[model samples]
Target: MPQTIQGFSRLNKEEKIDWLTSNFLSDSQNATSILKQYWNSDAKLQQLHDEFIENTVTNYYLPLGIAPNFVINNKTFAIPMTIEESSVVAAASKAAKFWMSRGGFKAEILGTQKIGQVHFTYTGDAQKLSSFFELTKSILLNDLKTLTASMEKRGGGITSIELINKNDQLANYFQLHVTFETLDAMGANFINSCLEQLAESWQREYNNYPVFSENNAEMVVIMSILSNYVPQCVVRAEVCCAVSELTEADGIDPEVFATKFVQAVRIAEVEPYRAVTHNKGIMNGIDAVVLATGNDFRAVEAGAHAYAARNGSYSSLTHATIENGIFRFWIEIPLALGTVGGLTKLHPLVKLNLEILGNPSAPQLMEIIAVAGLAQNFGALKSLTTTGIQKGHMKMHLMNMLNQLDATDTEKSKAIHFFKSNKVTHSAVDSFIKNLRQN
Candidate 1:
């Protein structure tokens, strides 16, 4: 039974933890200790973390790792990834090295447009509204000149605005569909601000417009917000190599692997079940880098998934081709990242990660993220088509299993050496540890 408390946010950090643990946790003291244990030792740093969100109890930490040897567009980079999952960093590094010898990855931004909308209800004639919109569109744009001055100076601002009629879908529904270009920033704040201002200006005009007044109808402004599903903010990254170069020492044929990999991608393209996991693998890489760089992974994820389902059915974000002794694998995804906003300036680690990548611009970051996704997908598909996913994944997971079982360093060393030639499983490792301890 949970008790609701008023002004929970007003409580201090320790007080908040006390209430949460007392109500929810069985071992309140232990949980409180664990939460406090992760807090930063430095007072300033701890305060920074606390102010990031409401109801702050303590910090939650994830491993910040580096996957080196990535060469995108002929430039080498060691990308930082913050994730709790095992084997993702390993797979990305392996795939990057594989492509490095094959001319590296080629990537480019396809588009950089973001959108926001103002929804409202009008019970008047659609034709009259259209005429009114046409007449006042310039006035509405002019009203925002002051608001958009700084953005326009920075080479980004409102690009277009359209009056959309949705009365057929819902009675008296309409929208102001606005597009923008906000270079070097995610622009959520900027987009929403412009939408709100536009809504304010548009409503004032609506009140004065005689057409709706003559019909004794009123236009009610609803809400204004920036959309995360930016289908227009897309980047493409790919790797290509001579078929002969894709050789494995285990005697798997390159052509056979390529064919199987392509088929696997094809299965994901048509099957929703497979597409979800297939895309998840890609996102494992994309989201890691996005988070490491201090951008919004949730927004990137939403946009990417919506873009994949743009054809009315969910499909793969990656594609493959084999022709003329050449094999090419690629991914195209919507990644609206920012290098100049949000946590980019606040988080210390984010600053270091950006420096590690040579301080790439927003579009450049998009290219890198897309390449990461493609590399991850390639690594996964290759493993799935050849040696099986568990062989490598479980091997990487052995350390975690050892930690869970509380094995000593000697036992862990023995287990690592033993599992090199043997398949890794929970029971086998448990038994190995038990037997080694007995002997």
Candidate 2:
């Protein structure tokens, strides 16, 4: 019989690894390799290792935290995420607990398809390229058949292709939007490859025209290089718990809190300055997961901000409201992420983290991330509405400061006590340590 290891968090690093090896389900050898690689003493390797150990890489298995009570589309899922932020996990769990008091999170993914664009520009004739797309739309669609076949077999395919002339002066550009169902993957690479092939075809077909110069015509510019226009997959959670349940946690008025939270988001949507931070709050969760999974966080960041400003103004990624005495939350983002190829396979720790997730396919992984983002947003908004964001975040920062000081357990306790008492400073901590030593 397998022995149950209780409270692994209380154990030392080595003890935790040992427990993981004996009973926790994971790739033991891989896990051991990553631990050893970082635990070594080589300076450069050690530096990289330390970064990995921290929340630097999101996929480097720190702890698998779960947000329980998430009822999406009538199914309950314990959403597992790898993130190191202090209040994110706690807040999400709190939100889920609150929602459980009502009907839970009712969510639906509109479709798993994502759109990628290939841009064509020529000085001579926009009309010509426009006509060309009209004439060769079938050919372009047929070329994507192999690329999209697997998705097609799974009840998804390259559904539509459209050509739009972007009004611009530097170059007359035609944007081709290819929509394909990605099943459960993020679909960046798949969509990019498809667009690459399309661009190559455009070059071959329009090579004869002087204005369509490969050297000067700007024949292909893959704008929105990654997929956007994600079919709106709406995930919503509403709970009708008595205002009583709110008291058990922190004496928060669920109805009043929810109403105030919605108002804050409305302010963020209408105001550019607030919109920046509002979206940043969303990215706080997104960037954490993107880093953990070994995906390009910068790209996701760029895409998210661009998507927020798609309507010519910055706006909040999530909308919140209280209806019928229940808190309702909804989020939509251009989450361009992937599970196959790239860093997902290149990095050792990323592989380990994915394994912890049971190596979910792309779409499943996206769903998990989407929910995590929603949960994280809830965490931030709730904190801002109830207690203010800095209170909880600053306490976590104080703990980090103590860790950096390399204080002993006793020293840490003393330092924290002094810090809270307004007597702690760099010089003060030094004096306290010196006094302790002298005694």
Candidate 3:
């Protein structure tokens, strides 16, 4: 049985590790060795990692890979990706190279608005609440000037604030829906702080209203926080080339391939079952770049999926079309990214990724992320229409399975050669290994 320990965070790093291993680990010494093995050789860097969060433990590492030959807006970039998935970088690189000769990807920022909300319950007359909001809206906006000054200096701050009535759905519920422009930072903390300040100002000013005096009812604020669903903070990435440009080495007609590709995208657009996986393939590229650049993949995922269902049905984030003797594939997604705050300035690899990406501004980063997604979709659709997804994906996945079995160098070499001509399946590899061992 384990016991809860108080003041656990007060313990130093080594002591905390000692207590954890002694109590929870079956082999305490081995566990300690394993944990220590991941520590950075540079003491200063290790200390920095330790202080990044509470209850410091050994560092965990993921492979950082570069997907090269991404040409966007006449400029070339080698996008960095941090992911555990084996084929994402390879697929993105293949797509980038495929488009490099076909005029590459073109990306643009559609908008750059983030949202926050202050929820409160008011039992007063709806008419009175609306009147009060109209009267006090400027007060709420003006009250936050001090908070917005720094953001304003950077050409971003509060964009708009509106009162929304939601009593029809939930009893006595109303909200202050606010919009913001955070130029380079992710702005979670900044948006949250401003919302809290607005709520405080509202509560203070509500008592002076004649409506509140007449009704003797208080406007109770439930909470104030930033929203991750930033539909307006959108970026669009597209690639287009002549239909005949989509030539095939496998002898399939280019026109047929282009038609199949468009149909595949349409299927994903209408069918939710395929759309989920289809969108996931897009995220495989988007999330990889997002993670590599040290932005929040979870938030990007939430906003993007919400936008996909903006038409009331979950659908593909990427769309494809072939018309007027040309084929075009593109994606429009809401991505809130930063180039200068949070982990961007802290993590070494994040800084390196930013440098490798030409240190794009928030909007530029959005364009990059969106292009990554579109490129990934193009790659997937190309394979899906022609060779089928599994043939290449399983081939890329071969190394992982081989690693799991801990095959020797000689065995791995043999397995790679064998799988080149034959299909890769776990049973086939297992039998191959078994026969190799027996012989």
Maximum-TM-score candidate: 1
RMSD values, in order shown: 1.2, 11.4, 1.3
The best-first sequence of candidates by TM-score reads 1, 3, 2
- The worst-scoring run of ten residues by lDDT in candidate 1 lies at 248-257
lDDT tens digits by residue: candidate 2, 320-366: 66656555567777665678777677666677767756686665566
- What residue pairs are clashing in model 2? 58-291, 58-292, 59-292, 73-107, 102-240, 105-237, 184-362, 184-363, 185-362, 185-363
Top-down lDDT ranking? 1, 3, 2
Better of 2 and 3 by lDDT: 3
Q: Once model 2 is optimally superposed onto the true structure by TM-score, how far is the C-alpha of residue 227 displaced, in angstroms?
A: 4.3
How much is 199 displaced in model 1, in angstroms?
Answer: 0.9
Q: Supply candidate 1's per-residue lDDT for 210.
A: 81
The regions of model 2 sitting more than 4 angstroms off are 1-85, 98-103, 144-151, 154-157, 168-170, 208-224, 227-245, 252-255, 341-361, 414-439
Please give the lDDT score at residue 382 for candidate 2: 76
The lDDT for every candidate, in the order shown, is 0.93, 0.65, 0.92
> Candidate 3: misplaced stretches above 4 Å?
none
Which pairs clash in model 1?
A: none
- Model 1: runs farther than 4 Å from truth? none
